[model samples]
Target chain A: MEQPEEVPHNPTEQAAICFKAFMLKNSPKSNLNLYDHLVRVLCKVMDERPENAVDVIEDLSLEVKRTGMRDKQSTLRDTPPVPAVQLLAEQQKTLFTRGSGDDVEPEEELVETPLPNLAEQSFYLEQAGVGLPREELQRIHLALKQLVDAQPLQTCRFWGKILGTQANYLVAEVDFREGEEEDEEGLQEDGADEEEKEGGAGDEDEEEATEEIDPLPVSAYKPPPAVPKEENHTGVNKFTYFVCREPGLPWVRLPPVTPAQITAARQIRRFFTGNLDAPIISYPPFPGNETNYLRALVARISAGTQVSPLGFYQFGEEEGEEEEEAARDSFEENPEFEGVPVPEMVDSMANWVHHVQHILQQGRCVWVNLAEKPEEDLEEEGDEEEGEEEPDEPEPEVGPPLLTPLSEDADIEGTPPWSCKMSSTLIPQFAIAVLRSNLWPGAYAYATGNRKFENIYIGWGMKFVGEGYTPPMPPAPQREYPSGEEITEALDPSLEEEQALQAALEERRAAEEEAEELEGEEEEEEEDDY
Target chain B: MGVTEDELKDKKALYSLNCIDWHLLPLPTPVLLAEVAAVAKGRFVGDPSFEYELTETRQQGEGDEAVKEEFTMKVTEEKRLAATVFNIEKDVSVVPRGAFIRTPHDTVQVNHSFQGLSTLEARNLGNYLHFTEPQQLKKKSILEMADLDPSIDFLDPLSEDILKGSWSLQMEGSSMCVLRSLLWLGLTFFHVPATPQHGYIYMGDGLKNLDLPFML
Candidate 1:
């Protein structure tokens, strides 16, 4: 409008040198310890002279990108490149100081051992809809009180979060003490003396190193037996596990469970990907990886869905001829058992029972390996070939025993893969029951009203099979090719004799023809010369 | 900071937690009620032709260039109970004999040469079929369906239905099986036995058991 104030004083000195190179190119490192929170957000937008000064500097940079200082600037972009004098000595410390005597108290914060009140056990396991998330039950009660103050456990617990595809696991379980079972059987006899020196180093390189470290091959796997080191503390090697991938990470442990990885994790169903060495793969294949298939799916979900309610466990007293004396009985703690009437544990899965053992479909709760010298030379070449095939082979199928009952398993669609329910159903005697399983969909268990119980699981370590994960298919293709035999007695000739007879006749005629040819040849030679 | 004294003297000891319940359980968050409905809409300014449609399309063009255009529309009541429970779950699920196959590009799948259904062919109903579409061999012919095997005969068999003993089956324990239907009251299905495992579910009340041909 009026171009004369010295031609806008060199265009306001080229707009103050383009606003000091746009505030030094959006000032991130002018030692940006948020430059006193960007000068207290430009003195609160020049003391609220706002009616939009670029919407109050875009609402104070979207309130400094919702403050965890953008997660400490995305964890300081994963750390390493610091220098400029240690980023100006970490921007001269005091980012927020106040009563900061360096808040100490973490010198091995164990406090001996008392965790379980997992927020009152997830508030009585969310009154039976079974729980978790209250910040993952306070990071699994501070990762099971730092795994019972790091080791010789004698009881640890917090075992839930499985749901893998990258990272879930959690687990824990434990037990140990009583001289830690001879130092866990001398570290499992040094992993059975390094798997018997990798199975005496050459049963053909241990069957090609178990078909290149197992995905089940070794001649369609038969092994499934060896569990008798006196049934390692009872049933699926009673309580040890560990796992981790979260809740302050480090745990791991998990070895014990073998009966050929509980018979290839009961013919593999697979899911777990919080990779503890992943490769389970599948199709009658999973012989090991994923820490022996999460210790044979936590010993087949602790011997088929853990269970408890009916007289909290008792049987123990066998103590003698152990070779599978009803799987050396075991079970224990029934201190005058009590609790089972949340309307009789919400009426029937036969009032729950299997407090862990029965495994069997040759997945062991005691199989014993039966004298192995190559299984007694394949039972003497199958007793010199089928001496009545040892009475038609059949018998391996055991299962259902330890305290048996969840109405003896089975029922998939028409219900009963342990459902139960209680925790209130209008206060059925201070209720607790629960149960759940439905073929391992996040397990559950629950009990209480005094003689407690437990189990838990938390899913995606798959099993409910049906409507999806179909898998099985590989068979049908023969479609007609076998039966064909038919060329009944034809060419009955004494061929050599017949040939000699014909040769004799031909020899005579040849001599005669030869003579006539010589005569004709001579005549022709002469005719040509002429 | 509570129940200590060794978890109140652990009676018979059971306290647990071994962690699982992965994600969906936190819930409770949604709050805003738009600042108490904008202070009760500045003290009452309701009903500007209030609405509650839920799906009834067909607009075309008008004011702000409106154009919903769902051709022949108006079918509410929750879209006729979601098209009668998706046509009775695509006419009662089923699936057995070589579970599911077709594919040589004619799409379908699951079959992996289906090694399942053996407990006496999962208790007969003529060894199941109908995972839908084959509607009575698409009205016969092809020389009266000469023993069809078009990659596990394209579905529809359930013992040539039209009401003959409406399904049933059973064996829910010695390795599952189940089946059910009875002309569709909460359907059912299952499978298991030899093992490729099977499925189907349905749960009821979307209403359909039309007196099942006067209860057979």
Candidate 2:
């Protein structure tokens, strides 16, 4: 048989394929350690390649500079730098072209001339800006080392936090035990040393006594036994577990908390009150203000998921259908369509109601008081009329209508006359809860559409009761003007009172005019004399 | 009436700002020019009592290759108002290709080259040319040229528009300081819009009406 045909081995092609495969496998882990390794390997490879290496280095340097600048601006400030691909390309080119001495020499010289300075400057700038200070860098390095070493343990805690399980408790217990043993050893040494000195024991005897009482055994002195793991105290663990591990979902790991996160959570909590289990509907907070912290929290919580508490009234087919049906029913029920422009009246009433509700929600009682004053006046007028006709004295009522009774007809406005006091008593608890929780600033389903109007009525009622008054009715439009004689007759008594007041005002005005005239005349005389 | 050279130069400058290139107008024929010359010289050209029809034509082709059409002029003399009407046998272009028009204060160029011309352009041009005289061409509108140059004196009424529109006045001589002041003004007054066309134009005053003379 002929000698086996020798196969040509293309190392460059093989390396290229291997590199591609490696990148494909590990590119997703763009974290710091892998990034550093890539950078170092690429640098080493480029150092061997002399030709086409300068361009690669320059491109890499530019990339590093760009990343350094971006890292400064990025919110995730501690993210590690990723080495430039150009650097790796340069290394590959250098490695492939290493045998060509003539091409490599000039390129090497060029790379050598500026490489150090560019690298130094880039390093200095990065360190000055985004890179941590020496102390911080040391701390980070140590922390990273610890993290790597204790990754298994940390992973357990992380999973435990997410799963709302007892993993964290078990870890805490283990740590507690180790701490107690160390403390016991320290205590025994201190106590035994003092006792031996007080007894003035010989050195050998002291040594013997020390040997007899083992320091390790002192650690066995256990305090009162810890509560059993199965025992539930205050149900805090159960609550945390429920919040962490709800059905049909994996536990989510929380990102490191920042000041912004804290503020956002607080704001969201303040608005939501009914039940923890209830879905939350969050509204975009006021723009250009710190109030967006609440919105940001809601955004974070709702991130990676579509579940939101504030999703009840999102514009959709169902909502539109309901609105249409309601409109139809309202129209059919209304009998008086002869002359009244129902739509305009309804719009105005809705607007008025909304205004009242907004004021109440804002905790502004003054506006409610203003609105109710007219109603109170009308009620008082009616009461006066009744009293005059009956000629009977009646005791004034003590307290305004209680809010609890108002809830029965809360949805309707014209059912019966009631004080705001009743409505407040009924809804105060819910309102207070809303105010305290993080949910107050955002949109809510109950606060939308006709519900807003209902809230306004409630607010108006609250103000009415608070101020102890009802709003007066508007006067009817005048059909015609009175004749001159009739007007004179109607105004006679009022005109007499007005005449007296006018005469006094006129006398005062006359005195003032005379004084002014005298002053003017005197000024003219002075001018003439001059 | 014949216009002086100075009047022509002033008109040229006004036309330049309005982007009107006047050199493109078609030259009148020798016979038509003779009639115009006779009329201008006050001689009984063709028929003083008997009416001779005058025609105007406008074409849209390039250079000397453009075509022309004829039209008739109906002239009426009244003590109340002077009126002239042109009757066209063929379509006579009402708007010239590059006639300078004025609206309120600013000049606008009439571009008949555009597929369809707005009537507003014709009305504006008529208003401006009707009101303006050759002598008044050099006199600029107080509001129009106010913010164009900053070297104007504040005390001068001619510079009132500039002064009013001036967003800043800094101590003279320092370029850096001036730049900083400008930067401050840019940050404070500039409204960076999501779209280029919708970007906010600071009108100096609080007025937001588009009809206002001010534009960025």
Candidate 3:
């Protein structure tokens, strides 16, 4: 909320200053004094008529300043000498004067006070500057409107990328064509069947011919069993492509395309053909690696020739000129066909075709034949191997010459030095080192005496090393001490100490035992006494 | 958490550079609706108008015992806030002929490093700074002055104000974390404010950290 610096400026700068002033006025801390300062500054700086600016600034300044001061006074903690009843009465009076309709009254009660009259204040300010005229404001407004309109398309492009719809245009076009066909078929077969029947023998012949032209045999054309549509379902447009079987067979029971889908398609198409310089296609993952369909599409498109009914077409005569121009330009510029030498365009088309074919082949939906190498090739190689095996018997004759020269040199040199060693001895070591370096750099570096390399390599290697060789161990269990009975036993005196303290009691117990032994004899006497 | 007017003002001052002119563009109803719904669903939660104060800190000493010196800036929302620090050393020693050297030679090895640092310290500091409650006043304020009728709600539950606010807060928080990491690096290493002699080193380091989202 720093105050914008004031300087002599142009119209754009003046407009900016005005905007800043407006923003400042809306800020929570703004007061009439600040508003007045802003208006005066704007009036001084703008090229607009000085009288109108001054009047607006002055009126706004006074009104705002008065309101702000009054607000401040009421907010002070010090209570007025007047009773609460009087205050309430005054409040009611203000409320009554302020249009106390059912809604307005309730709102006023909720707010507890009048809200700032922003519209009223702004209106008065504008009224005061009426001399400045409305044309200028209109121009500014129009400029702002234009700026606003351009943003969404840009945003759509940005978000489209984020949403991973890179081939939006191509997908949309395909969807559109599919939708139109479904709709036309739906109309023809459903309600239009009666009309066709009424049209007589010619229509019937056409229908029969259409049925015959369908590639699938009548037995294979058994429609998929229909599922009941759920209640409250948002239906799709039947005219659009809903779903198709493998090898590009259109669905028979087409659903209507939703408005949302149509919009999405349109947006995507606009994005591709409008902004993008190249033809974009979406090769969704195919089933079972059947890439032929995708490859065919790519090849057809790459030729700069339409795949007849499947390719893009101008919608009407009005668009025909544009479409023809675009097609001609594309044909001339795209080197995928016999055209201009646009290497980039050619490369892109080739890449697209390759990628499409690859995706279709590897896709989950498409089925592909592996076509493993012919068995005859393997047999021929095997025969060559057998012929080479027969030559091995003369290997000793070849080996003796190869070894004798080396042995003679070794004899003269008192055995070959380590560096001069060849074949088996050096090969194993070198292979092991190479393999070790690739697999476990740490172990390799450790053996090679490279410290820095060992540090990084060893750090990574230990993570994968087998079982017991692993360094870090899992956490150990915690032990808890016994309580209750254990604590009581620890606190209690020994039995021996107790017995020492109670010798007389032990003697009494012995005397009682002796008495008990005599009790059998005494019992006869006690029975007589009883 | 509900924000006080003062807090709101402070936030506007603190992270203004992150602000985008979304208001300048008119969006389709569906897009706007989606944005609003996201805010209402708590997918968006941030203060869009907040500005961040940029600060640069350099370690003052050599090796392990380096202390730090700091320079702070209160930048406006429009300007990009960035800092660069460099490490430079001059080598004037001459090499003598030896078995390893092979021949007499004079070599000077100068090492210079540069790093571009972002200024988001204010956001981190925001987490620590607590505001004192203002004393209740009887005076009418702008909040009281701008009261609207209860029957009328100018904005829907998923309005631009709420959505933009939420997004700004989330993005700002992430940016703050990134800035903290950069500051940590500065504090760890003994670096000097970027100069022509050490520009290369700073540039290289800066490039290494450029993938960091909030870096200028």
Q: Highest TM-score among the candidates is held by which one?
A: 1
Name the 10 consecutive residues with the lowest summed lDDT in model 3 chain A: A155-164
Considering DockQ, which of the candidate structures 1 and 2 is the better prediction for this target? Answer: 2
Ranking by lDDT: 1, 2, 3
DockQ of predicted candidate 3 = 0.01
| TM-score of predicted structure 1 | 0.25
User: Best to worst by DockQ, what's the order?
Assistant: 2, 3, 1
- Worst-scoring 10-residue span by lDDT in model 3 chain B: B90-99
Candidate 1 per-residue C-alpha lDDT over A115-156 given as tens digits, one digit per residue, 9 for 90 to 100: 456676677778877676586566557666666656766666
- Model 1, B68-102: lDDT tens digits are 85443222232233344445646786778677776
After the best TM-score superposition of candidate 1, give how far the Cα of residue A451 lies from its true spot, in angstroms.
Answer: 6.9
Model number with the top lDDT: 1
- How would you encode candidate 3's per-residue C-alpha lDDT over A1-530 as one tens digit per residue? 33456563688878878876676574456434455555655644474545656557766656545655677776557655874335534533432233324355575544532222223322322322211124322322232222222221111000000001121111111123222222454464455356534765664566588777875433323222122221111111111211111111111222332222222222111111111233333222211111222222222121111111101121344444675332211111122223212222122222111101111111211122222222333375475433422212211111111001111222111211111111122333321111011111111111111110111111111111111122223446545455677556565769897877578655755676677876565546644653
Q: Which segments of model 1 are wrong by more than 4 Å? A: A1-303, A314-328, A332-335, A340-354, A358-362, A375-425, A428-432, A440-463, A466-530, B1-88, B93-158, B161-166, B169-216
Q: Tell me the tens digit of each residue's lDDT in model 2 across B85-183.
A: 010100111122122233333333332333322323321212112112223323657785575332211112211222222222211111111100111
Candidate 1 is graded, for docking, as incorrect
Comparing only chain B with the true structure, the TM-scores of all models are 0.28, 0.18, 0.15
What local lDDT does model 2 show for residue A133? Answer: 32
In order, what DockQ does each candidate have? Answer: 0.01, 0.01, 0.01
lDDT of 3 at B143: 85
